[model samples]
Every structure is written in C-alpha cells, then in structure tokens.
Target: MTLPTPLTGVVPPVCTPLTPDNEVDVGSLTRLVDHLVTAGVDALFVLGSSSEAAYLPDRHRRTVVDTVTGHVAGQLPVLAGAIDMTTLRVRDHVVAVTAAGADAVVTTAPFYTRTHPAEIATHFREVAAASPVPLFAYDLPVSVHTKLGADLLLDLAAEGVLAGVKDSSGDEGTFRRVLLGTRARADITDFSVLTGAELTVDSALAMGADGVVPGLGNVDPEGYVRLYRYCRSGDWARARAEQERLCGLFAMTAVGDPSRMGGSSSALGAFKAALHLRGVIDCPATAVPQVPLSSGEVERVGKYLAAAGLL
Candidate 1:
C-alpha cells in the first residue's frame, strides 16, 4: 500500500524483539509484527527509540528494517528510524534502511554536539535530499537536547524537506503551535503531525494531530486503533474512555524502581514484558547497558495489562 499523503491513525514504534543473546529474534519479531497487523494499526515503525535503535549496531538495525518491511510485504507502510548524531551518519542509515525496504525515514536533529538552528536546518535538508523515501522529523527534545521549534519544523515542511513530524517532545504548547501552523498553511496539506505522548492522545487528536506514535501502542495496538477510530468518528466520549484505559496501562512504565534504572529501561522493559505476557514476542530482554526489569516489575506490568483488559 502506498503511504498516505498525511499518514494517519496509530503507527506504533514497534519494539525490537531480541533473543537472550541480544541478536535480532526474527521469528519473534515476525510474530510481533503479525500482532500489530492484526490489531489494525495503520503502519509500523522499526528501529526507533521504542525499538532500542540507539543501542542497536548497524547490522541489527538493517536486520530489523529488512525483516519488518519484508514481512509486511507492503501491506503497511514501514517507517524506519535513521537516527544518529550527525547528518552523514543519519544519511547512511537512511540509505541502508531504504535499501532494506523501509517506506520512509524518521530522524532527529543533530545531537552529542552543540548545533546552531541554521546547521540543524541544513542537516535535515541534506539528509532529506539524500533519502530515497520521504523524510519525517522526530522531535524528541529530551533525547536530542534540541527542541525543534515550531517555526523551523513548519518552515521545513513548507519547503517539502519533511513529509511529517512525530512530536515526542512532551510540550503541549509547542505541539499545538505546530498543529496550528499546519492548519494555517495552505501549502501544508499533506504533512503529518503525530504525537508520541501516550496519556494525552485524546487531547492531541482533539487539537488536530493527524495521528499518534505511542510506544504503549506496541502492547495494546487494538486500544489505540479503537481510540483513533473513535476520534475520527467524532465519538469523543468513547475516545476519552479508551484513552483513559491506555493511560492506566502506561503506568506500568513506573513499575521499575528509579534508583535501579532510568526511565528508558523501565518503560521499554515494561512494554516488552507486556508484549511477552500477551504472547506477541518470545522474550522481553532489552539491549545492554539498560537495566533489566526484575521479575516483580514484570509481574506489575502483567497486572497493568490485566487491569486494562489486555491479558
């Protein structure tokens, strides 16, 4: 299927299923993909933050994109994260994932070094020019350390340098500003604005976001799909209910003790655990350097799933 002009609906940043040894578990990954497909998600995103792209080496990254895109066989658009600290590095990922059959590439602004906004703009332009598929900006200020200002994103979108943006900044003011800018621009009809804020999905959709890229959606994609459909159909009451249930499930991210692990480990581990508990993946092991959730934490995630009716 061709990517929609403004890609809409729930596009989960799929968790990368890995073996106990940290290799790409292709069989488990395929099962996870099938699970998402069965849940009616509009698209799949691989090698993203939720997929541990930051920790994955180039080889595993390629395997992920190749496996997911090849498995889907064009049934859904596969957006791969071409993430790196510099333009050249990110461009290389773009080429590799594109060659591996990704439908589009999502990248963040330069990181690990202080960069002027002009340089950031140049970086995106150069990367977009080199990418074979459409490019989407990943606005994740927490990770990248540079907020993608609304004007800059809109400017790039207006210039056709970006096909869309997945705003994970957790800044409602700026997200709304970007949405308003897109709505105000006559030339920005086909640009997508997706929110990664799991708890505020209903509010984001009500504020005109085109879609959501919730990491939690990886576990309960059916819920996000239902929320999207409810919002699209103007069933605000039902939309809020679904959103609230997902919010309850999202609390599982807090199950891991903060002193033992950072939010990435806790949240990602909870997600993988839930996927494992749901029988979507074989193992819930996250990449190295990130602390693993204890059995107690995993049990807590199961409780959240049960409370959300996912179990």
Candidate 2:
C-alpha cells in the first residue's frame, strides 16, 4: 500500500506486549494494534519510546515491526522506531524496517553522551542517504541529550535527509521556530513536525505543526483521534476540552516517582496500564526493574480515568 505523510492527527507510540514468561507477546500485540486502528488513529508507530524499544533485542525489535505490519495490512501508515545510537546499528535497523514493509522510520538522536550539531546533522544525513524509507527525526531532547536546532533541521530538509521531526523537547518556542523554518521551504512541505508532548498538542497545531505523537493515544486512541479532528476542523473549544481530558489522564503517569519504579517513571508504563484497564491488551507488563504502579498510583490512575470517562 502507498503511505502518505501523516502530517496531521495522532500517531500513538504503542506499548510492547509481554508474555508471562517475559517474551514479546506477539498475539497480544496484534490484538492491541487492531484495537488502536479500529479506534481511528491516523497511524501507528512501532518500537518507539512508548513501545520500550530499548529493552528488546534487535531480533525482537524486527519481530515487532513484522508483526505490526502484518496486522495492520497497510491500512494506515506504519512507522518503525530506529533506536540505535551507533551508526552501524542504526543503519542495520533501517535495513530491517524497510525489509519488514514499514511505511517510514522514526529515529532519535544519539543519547547517553551528547554530540555537537555538526555531528547530529552528519548522523541524520548518513541515515537519510542510506535508508530505503523516509526518515523522521525523533527530537526528544529529554531522552537524547543532544537537541536538533531548527537551522540543522532546515539543512537536513534542504538536503532531503529528513522527512520531518517529532519535537518532544517540551519547548514550544523551539517547536515554533522549527515549524516556521520548515514551512518557509517550498521543498520542505513533505517535512512534517509532530509534537511528542501530549500537553503541547494544541499549541503545536496553533504554531503550524503537522501532527502529534502522544503516548496517551495508546490507551485513549479515540480521544486523540477526536481531538486531532476537532483541531483540524477549527473547533478550538471542543479540542481544548478534549486536550484537558487527556491531560488529566497524563498527570497521574507523569507525576509518579521514577527512581524505585522505572515503569511508573515512563509514559509507556502508564500507556500499558491504561490499555490493561481498557482490556485492549492482556497484561500491562513492563520489563522488570521498571516496576508496575503501586496501589496508590493505580487508584489515582483509576480516578483520572473515571474523570476522563475512560474507565
């Protein structure tokens, strides 16, 4: 199937399913994918930050792409996360994602150690040149210490090295700058900017962003789909109300302690927990060491869900 740029709408970073034995639960994953698609999401991004790609082995990651691709059957755009920090690893992932029939690939800047803007530009240049599929720069500075400047982004877009970026820096100013930079280029219309932070969806759209990649979309897929539609339709009032609803759900997960409980530390765990609540997936299992929600946290999540009418 031909895949178009999902310039607007919600693309959920789906949670990775796990077996009781702790393996990738392929069956559960397919069901979850089907559920999200049925709920009206514009696209599906696999092995993303919310999908916990860093925990899985390369083989497992490739399996996830294959599984989701087959389940989706080209109904919507399918984006695979390129999670490698090493050049060789990133290239290998690109090869695998293309071979698995992914519609596009989303990649984060190298993390753990920060690299210069020149190096960042070079890294994406190499990937974009070698990749068989379009590359979306994953710009979540919180996850990756290195940030992509709008000038660097413009250079990449000019060179056709980047299809777009997912701006999760939580910096609306930077997002606006990048959006304006990309929008100014006639050749860069193909370049899209997605808001990775749920709280910034409305602001990003108002700033001329293309779309959003919200973790909450994994659980409340319908809410996000509705929210995006409302925004695009110029119904700010309804969109604002929906955004508030999602923010309420996000607060519980965002407020948890991350040191002792790594799962609670991430939106991924909260995403899975919400899925478990909705019965979309069998278990809300995050990899070990990332502890599950505490009783208090779970109760708080329940209240948030009830208030949001998701429970």
Candidate 3:
C-alpha cells in the first residue's frame, strides 16, 4: 500500500522478540504484530530503536522486515529502520528492508564521525537518491549525536528529499518550529512530522505534529491509539487523562536498577517483560549483552501492567 501522503496517527515502534539464543523469533514477532494491528495503530515501525535495530545483525534485520511486512500484508504501512553509522551502510539496509517488502525506510544522520551540517544534508540527499521507497529522517540526537536542524529539514522537504521526519530529539522548542515551519511552507506539502515523545503525545498533537511513534506503545498500543483518537477528535481533557495514564505506565522503564544495567537494558528489558507478562510473546529475552531484568523488576512491570488495566 502506498504510504499516507502525510502519515498520521499512532505508529508504534515495535520491540523485537528474541529467542533464548537471540535469533528473531518469528512466531512471537507475528503475535506482537497482531497485537498492534488489532489495537488500531496507524502503522508498524520495525527495526527501530525499540526493536533493537542497532544490536541486531544484518541477517536478523532482514528476517524482521520480511516477517513483519509479510504478516501485515498491506493492512498498514510497514516502515523499517535502516539504521547505520554512515550513508553507504544505511543505503544497503534501505535496499535490504525494501527488498524484504518494507513500504518505507527510516534512518538517522551519519554517526561515529563528526559531521558538518553540509555533510549531513549531503548524506541525506545521497541516501534518498538511492532509496527505492520513501525515506524519513530519524532525528534522534541521543543516538546519532546530531540534532537535525529545522532549516535543514525544511530545505530537504522543499527539495523532496525527505518524505517525513520522526523527531525523537525531545526538544519541544525545535519540534514546534518544525511543525510551524512545515505548516507555513507552501512548497513543502506532504511532509510528515511524527513525534517520538511517548509522554507528550497530547501536547505534540496540540502543537500540530502529524503523529506519534511511542516506544511505550509496545506495551499499551490501545492506550496510544485512544490518546491519538482523543487528540484528533479535539477532546483535550480525555487526551490529557490518557496521556497521564501512559506517563504512569512509562515509569516501569525505570524499575531496573541503574547500578546493574544501562538505560537500554532497563527500558527495553521492561518492555519485553511487559509483553511476556501480557502473554503476547513467549520469551522476554532481550538481545545478548544487555542485562536481563531481575525477578523484582519483572514483578514491577506486572504492577504497572495491572494498574494500567492491561493485565
């Protein structure tokens, strides 16, 4: 299916389910896909940050894209992340995922090397030129170490090099500027600006963001869908209430002991644990090298789930 001109509504960044040995568990992956699709998300984003794309090998990434897109079967757009350290590598992923049946590809700026804005612009243009499908810029400064400037994004939008942007920078001021700038630019039609801020869906939608890619939505897809519907229908009160509830659920990410694990371990571990508790997937095992959540942390995830009425 063709992507929506301006992709809108809730699009959850799906978490990858791993086997005991760390292979992509296709059975669990499909089950998770059904969970999100049945919950009424607008799209499915696989191999994203939430999916542990950075940790997975190239073969596993292909398996994920192929599995999800084939399972989705055109019900909704399947956007795969072509995350890498530079242009050529990203291009290779873009080709692989698209060949594996992804509708579009998302990527971040080149990283691991200091890059100028001009270089960033050129990198995007080069990648876009080679991409077989629509390309979305993933502005995740925390991961890429490069914040995508509004002017650069707008300039690219004007040039039709970028079909959309998934802004995960968490900078409200810059996010608002992108929204307003896109709205004000007559030449930049069909440029989607999706927010990755899980806790601020209401405010971002209020400020005119096209949609959301909430990682927490992996655990509570229905909540994010409800939040999106509430915002789109102009029910600010209901939206705020739902957002606050999700904010509470999001606290589960912090349940892991900081002394024992890194942020990815805590956050991603919590998500997989929630999914396991909810019986959507079999094993809650995260990719290797990331510490597993303790039984205590898993119980805490259960508490969050129970409180959210998900259990």
Candidate 3 residue-wise lDDT, 39-123, digit = tens: 9999999999999998999989989998999999999999999989999998889889988888888999999999999999999
Clashes of each: 0, 0, 0
lDDT of 1 by residue, 141-204 (tens): 9999999999999999999999999999999999999999998999777999999999999999
Which regions of candidate 1 are displaced past 4 Å?
Answer: none
Q: Local distance difference test, per candidate?
A: 0.93, 0.80, 0.94
Clash pairs, model 1 backbone? none
What is the Cα-based lDDT of residue 306 in candidate 3? 94
Where does the lowest 10-residue lDDT sum fall in candidate 1? 1-10
- Reference-based TM-score of each model: 0.99, 0.94, 0.99
Rank all candidate structures by their lDDT, best first, as comma-separated numbers. 3, 1, 2
Clashes (candidate 1): 0
For TM-score, candidate 1 versus 3, the one ahead is: 3
